[model samples]
Structures are given as structure tokens and as C-alpha cells.
Target: MKKYVRGLAIVGVLTLAVAACGSKPAENTAGGDANKDFKACMVSDSGGFDDKSFNQTSYEGFQAAVKAKGLTPVKAESKSDNDYPTNMTAMVAAKCNVIVAVGFKLEDATDKAAKANPSIKFAIVDSAPATPIENVKPLSFNTAQASFQAGYLAAGMSKSGKVGTFGGLKIPPVTIFMDGFAEGVRYYNKQKSKNVQVLGWDDAKQAGLFAGGFEDKAKGQNTAQNLITQGADIIFPVAGPSGLGGLQAAKASNGKVNAIWVDTDGCVSAAEYCSVLISSVKKGMDVAVQDAITSVVDNKFDNKQFIGTLENGGTSLAPFHEFDSKVPAELKTELDTIKADLIAGKITLESKAQPKAS
Candidate 1:
């Protein structure tokens, strides 16, 4: 009787171990089965999380979606452009139902990966694949409208009557921001009858300082300083990561200078210079990502591209933080009017190849 009892106990232990092993595969497979639960994944560009620009904004969006849907979300950060493909592949292999790639820099890699993994769904920010895949969705922003607001504010607030803009690359998105900014300045000038000169990238020449790369803060600082020395009291740094250098330069200039930040709210993100930042171009990535994930959760994930524009309430200008009191009441009123006009199609912020001279 004792021998029989011991043998039964051993068998029970084995049964429990086997049950535990069976549960492991369920957890692994649970994420991929859309019928059960959807898993979302993201692969970031070389800028990483703290770049204080596109990467951070995109990540925030992805996180919001994950939280809202109660879905498992994974992120693979690329140290360089070369790592994009490999990191993307790893997420695909993990059976992520949806993968979001941040930044235009990941366009090529994301395109290749999406094609290779036909079963996987993809969403990319700031870019669209050349050939649209049925499974991939593109998300782009109307940065022009937001930047135009920044320009209008800068033009109205510039003490020196000169504002400048610098970009890391002359890409369409960056150029669109610059174009809208220039137009805003022109609009402000036309409305107020003031001459505010804009320097740095010329829409006509289609030329500007690249800073060679986006990660070089020193270059950004120097570029901004040069623009400041040329009598630009307000400067817009549209270059990701490098924009921080511009902010630093503005701070070192002893509060006489101010800057406009891009992608995220610089006031909250860069609190040290919040006092100097006039405003920021707001991109609603958080909302976009949340919407994308919700669609997946509700089994309504459609192969539709998302365009975040002013009309859609996907982008706007951040409120004046420390400059709230400094900005005149009249200027604020005028800015509101302009925003309304732009939204209502009363005013069009058209992209032009020629830079209007101050």
C-alpha cells in the first residue's frame, strides 16, 4: 500500500509539470491570435526615446494605445539606421499583430519588412510606403498648418523683426514646416504692416545647413547662434534631437532670445528653457496611435492612412507657457483669428518654392 501511494504522488507531480509547460505556449501564442487579443509593437529610429522629438512623441502614442486596449506592446529601439531592419524583423517574428515604425528614416526598412511579412500589419509615422501594401497603413501630419501658427506668433513677437528657421534635412516634411512658417510671417506682415525677415533655409534656393546629422547638438546650437547674431530674435529649430541645441543657445543668450520647438511641447519636456520657448508645434501622435490600436481591438482595423491636419484637430500650436503675459493681448487675438481662418478655409497656407523677402 505504501509503494502504491508513492507511485501515485510521483505521477501527480509529473502531471502538474506538464500542465505548467502547456500554459507557457498559451502565453506566447495568446498575443498573435487576433480572435483572442491583439499585440502591438513599435520599432524606433536611431533617435531613440529621449531625443525629445519625433521618437518620444511616437512612443507616447504607442503607449497610450497599449494602455487603452489592454494589449501587450513591445518596442525595439534602433541605435542606428542599420539596426532598423533587424529590430523590425524581431518584432515580426514575435507575431505582433500590428507594428508601428516611427519617423521617416524607417520608411525603407519598414517597407521591406512589411512586404516580407505579408501577414503582419504595419503603421509608419511621417512616411508612406512607395507601393502601398494592403496590410500597411501610413500616418502623416499637416505640420505646415501648425508651423504657420508658430511663424505668425514669432513674427508678431519678434523684437528685432527677424526670425530664422533651421532644419536637419531638407525633406518634404521639414520643408513644409519651413514653408508654412514663412507664409505665416508673410501673413503677419501683410496684416500688421511690419517687416519681419526670415533667414536660414530659403524656399527658393532650397538650401540650408544640414548639421550633417540630427544628433549633433553642438551644431544645432552653433547654427542657431549664427542666426541670432544675424539679428534673429526668434528661431525655429525643426531638426530633431538637434533642436535641443537651439534651445540651449536661446537660454545662453540671456532671455533676450526665444525659440519654437517641434514635435512635442517643449515647455513641459524642456522645463529649464520653458521660460524662453515662445510656443511649440503640437503633433497629436498620442491620439493617432490610440485610434489605430482601438481599431485593431474593435476588429475594425482598416487599411486606411491617417492624416493629422489642423482641420482634423490632429495638430496645433501649444499654448504660450512663460510668454503668456509677455505676448500682447492684441497679438493673441490676431493669432486666434488666423487659426480660425486657417481651419475654416478662409486662409490657405500654401507651400511655395519662393521665400518671400521681409
Candidate 2:
């Protein structure tokens, strides 16, 4: 059977079976509608909930799960990394039963919070603690797998024979996308005997351009423009909301350039740039978030890490939306075959950033 692929809008489906482990009922809260009083809380990274990328998608899943279980929902938005600990503390004080801290940046804070409160269950997205804690669950995604497909798509579609990708920061989660994209371009070149150049990232050197943070749109725009000036027609920005600037750069190019978004479907999250986007590399953060919440509601929460991958419907390529008709059918078929190959272990990736097996 083929693996499942999900976009940002279809997050309502609770299809995170591959990522979540089977849970055993909790000793203390096993019966009598635990969900009614169960509190699901979340603390966002610096990007806040409307980022149209990571935070937004995760928040959507969190909200969906809370609504489905009729549980109380509470959220805290961090203005910067400094706020992680404070916000986490606030969630704890709110008497939350389960707390999820979004982003790798919050790993330290989440760890501290989890350690300080043994009674509360905690989960952190995109990061794992240095030392494992019995109460903290890790929610991670192997985006490199899906990003490889996206890289190949960009290479196959690039009219200039040059495609580029940049990141918000030089972190594992961010660079995982870059590494796969660069490798995919190399793979395409080897397969087709075509020298399609990739700018912004070099997997061999493990070096590339970065926007320094996930919030600066102008910086994202400038960085993308730099790639464009180098003759790249397809730009993939792995930055969060900052990536919207890359789309703005593409839009300014008129018919000369296009882009691929990261984390969520650009067509739905950043619709203004839909005309310029070929597709998006989507992470099923929402699905995983809901699954985590559900486990709590069922009184079966565990600390095992949840790693999303192409095989599990966790990470996938978004539909080609406005470019659906424009994307050659042959290319689409090739992508499907590539996805199957990856899922079946016929193909493998070299990204060092892939989540460690649990």
C-alpha cells in the first residue's frame, strides 16, 4: 500500500498512527470521562500562533483535539525565546494537565518545566531533551524525506536550471529541509545527467545562508533576492513567517520566478503568493498535536517520542494547487514513484538532521 500524504487544511484527520506508540491507561485517571476536566495547553515559539507556518499548524491541531474531546484549551504566545520559560510556567500555574511547547527553541524550557513538575505531562515539538525525562514526550518530524521530493520537483520544474533554498536559522529542524533539498537536486542531476545548480545550501559542506531568525520578513526577502540574482528561478524558503518574504520576492519577479513553502501549504497559509508557489513541503504537526492531546484525554499519555515521516502520513508534499495544471503530469508521476521508493526503503537520505529512532 502507498503511504498517506497530507496538506495543512486536512489536519482534522487523526491519522498519526505511525508516529504515536500504543498507550496503556494511566494509573490515576483511567475512567469516568477524564476529558471533561482535562486541560490541554500549549506555548508557542517566538512566531506566535498566526505565523502561517509551524506554530499556526500545530495550534490548529491542538484546537481541533481540544474541541473534539470537549477539553479546556489554554495557549501562551512567546514574543521571543526568553519568554519560553515564563510562558511554560504560566501554563503550569494554569493547572494544565498536559503542556506542549512548540519548536526546538523551547527544548530547554520544556525540559526544565517537565523536571520541576512531575505531576504534569509535557511534550516538546522539533526538539528532544539532552537527557530523557519520563514525563516529556518529543514530537518530531523527518522533513528531510518529504523535502527530498520537493527538491526533485523544483529541479525538474526549474526553467533556469538553478534552484535555491535558505533557512530561518541554522538549526537541525531548519537545516534538515535544506540538506534534503540540496541532496534532491543532486539526485535529480545524477538521474537526468543535467547539472541543475542549487543555491543557498551545500549539503557536502553543511553550510548555507540563514535569515538569523524566523520573524524578519525583510531579511527573508533580501536573502531570497540574493538567490534570485544568482539566476535561480525556483526558491524554497525554510524560514517560518520570514519565508513569506521569499514569496514576496517571487511575486515581484512576475513570471520569471516561483517558490515552494515550508511547514504548511502556501496556498492555504500564504494565499497571496499562491500564484507564484509551485507547492509546499508540509509537516503534519497538527495531526501529531491532536494525537498527543487525545492520548491525554484517554488517560493513556506516554513519554515516547513521536517522529513524523513520509511513511506515516506525518510529513508530505502539499498539492500543486494553482500550479496543478502547470505541473507536468510526467513530473507528478515521477514524484509519486519517488515517494513510494522512499517509503519502501528503495531510496534513502543522507541528512544528519533526521530524528533519532525512539
- Largest TM-score belongs to which candidate? 2
TM-score, prediction 2: 0.90
- Taking all chains together, each candidate's TM-score versus the true structure is 0.86, 0.90
Each model's lDDT: 0.72, 0.81
Cα lDDT tens digits for candidate 2, 134-174: 89878889999899999999999999999999998888888
Regions of model 1 farther than 4 Å from truth: 1-37, 352-358
Query: For model 2, what is the C-alpha lDDT against the true structure?
Result: 0.81
For model 2, the superposed segments whose C-alpha errors exceed 4 Å read 1-36
| Residue 269 local lDDT, model 1 | 74
Could you tell me which 10 consecutive residues in candidate 2 have the lowest summed lDDT? 1-10
